[model samples]
Target: MTDSKLKVALVGCGQIADAHLGEIRRILCARAVAVCDQYLDLAKQAAARFGVPGVFTDLGKMLAEVRPDVLHVATPPHTHRPLALQALAAGVHVYVEKPFTVDVTEAEDVLAAAVAAKRLVCVGHDQLYDPAWQECRDLYQRGELGEVVHVDAVLGYDLAGPYGRVTASDPDHWVHRLPGKFFHNTIAHALYKITDFLRDEEPRIFATWFGALPGTDCPTELRVFLQGADVTANLLSSSAIEPSQRVTRVYGTRRVVEVDLDGRLLRQARAPTLRGPLVKLELPWRQKREAARSLRRNLWHFLRSRLHYFTGMHRLFTEFYQAIRTHGEPPIPYAEIRRLMAMMDQIFRSCRANERLSALANEERRLNGQPVPISPLDPPLTTHHSPLTNP
Candidate 1:
């Protein structure tokens, strides 16, 4: 291992590239030596903003000249595999953003190339490493949550937000071209949170896709049900939900742990010991106390300049650099990466099947002079009085 600080380079100067640049600056052991993008102006702008020394329009040139120890691939999903393979071939470790590849096959190819090059690669499942999620993980690992009974992972998207607004308007946006469309690009942040409890490699998945927002043809809402060996999980990715959030609630025999990724808060709810009315009163007070504690903790972190929105990204980069220096395993295991990709493949397949069957059923109803069934997208998931509502 080199005694000098690790040199990092980033490719794809999009919105996520800014995140990588900002977080890399926070890691004392690493520095952004170079930035690259197809658009020379974007690369130059990022380098200037981040105080990066090297800027390039060509990735090969950057790899040859700057020779960074790590490369952050912040490009679109389809470009991840090739860019990563190129970096690995040049003896550079890779840190890719979520939806590591378009599909499982591409994921395997990149991982295999990394093994052949004797380098390491990590996917940017940042939400799983958030501080609140870390606390939830610790509780589950220490058996404080007991055996997991069920899990709910919710990722709310705001169509009116900066990125969403652009994607909704741009027909040629990269996200629209992906196989699963927006779901492929974003649902990973939600699904990865539940993978810890639903460890079955080949879980039964039932997924439905629908358009919740009035936008392009692509669906804006996704509902997925996964049944693993002993645990079952539900994942919701909705752009219609108000005040969008990224939350995961794990229900165990002994307790319930909810990690609010947006607010960076962790709360636990336990079965009431008191009988009848007292139990209801005590529960609300206990929840209030937990919320207050979370508020104070976040305030302390904020004072220390550690409560930034991308703190999870900063922590992940720090750990990955440490792993590279020590030749240790990455923060996320390769098996987990493959597992996630495989699950996505199955879920997307189910979504397609659902669409096909819906079309057939609707046609049959029309021929019989009956009213057409409502598509899943016709109404928001929130309006449905289903068991999926958080307990």
Candidate 2:
């Protein structure tokens, strides 16, 4: 829409804002013109950090004055809906953080607003843009990995960290207020990575929740099984565990590829021979060659420091910016966003229903004088939680 350079404005000054600032600075077609936040000092700090000349404590004021071509809604998930709607209403394209809204209805509303305003909205589902993830996608697309059989997307968290501690201690925190709570804020990272490979309109879910740290009300340990028509996906987010990593392992009919997102590594495993012990000898070499290639690529990124950390964000932002500048289709389509939100809403609702059903089954057994046993509907314990299916 812009023949000239795009003026990008960011509306959050938190940690993720730094990533947006970096990429906005790097993109030749766009520049950070202003930043806004409720905290004036945070806005000032980001403005100073990014050399953004305009800063505002109010988003409305910033929109009225600078009228940025694109706005990044990096605020908390709860604030995403209103802020995004506001940006669309003002005829500004929006890029919002993951879990684009707290729930499906809000996501739909934002999409509708974007349509009405003739603007675009891109979710910060940036992980799939990471180099390693992109390579994995390419492999699948080219049929080098064969048909995707299953997907396992895992994310680990450190509960002692600032975010965890803050949410754990504050009952009134925006995270706790979310319909899906902490999981809502994060499930997108795990789900969006592999959902495209799934063919089903609505995947059935089996979920499990437990607190790794006893006496804590927050369910730090969680897992979900997503059953697709052709490919199944396992989504894991465990704050109770350590060795924090973001990884997605894709199983294919002919081979399996492991996409280590945090490590920025990709490995392919395949039948190295038509027959016999030769494959035993050939497979390791094949894996080693792939790993080494990935290492070289990652090393190149590492030499750059800050860019290495925000590589995916940078790529995602660049593509979105280019599409806007060229009047091309949005980088991620609105229908995809709708499908993603629907999947998430179903996951949250189905899991809660599972919990309630489990409780009810227990009560039923006690009243009927039958021996109490674990309900089949109840999530079974494993590295995975139970499936949360819609009744």
**Candidate number achieving the greatest lDDT relative to the actual structure:** 1
Q: Give the poorly placed runs of model 2, Cα more than 4 Å off.
A: 1-3, 212-216, 274-281, 303-307, 362-391
Worst 10 residues of 1 by lDDT: 382-391
Best by TM-score: 1
* Residue-wise C-alpha lDDT for candidate 1, range 256-330, written one tens digit per residue: 999997888888999888888999899999899999999999999989877889878888888899999999999
Q: Tell me how far candidate 1 lies from the true structure as C-alpha RMSD in angstroms.
A: 4.3
Q: List the RMSD of every prediction in angstroms.
A: 4.3, 3.5
Off by over 4 Å in 1: 212-215, 377-391
lDDT for predicted candidate 1 compared with the true structure: 0.88
Instruction: Give me the displacement of residue 197 in model 2, in angstroms.
Output: 0.5
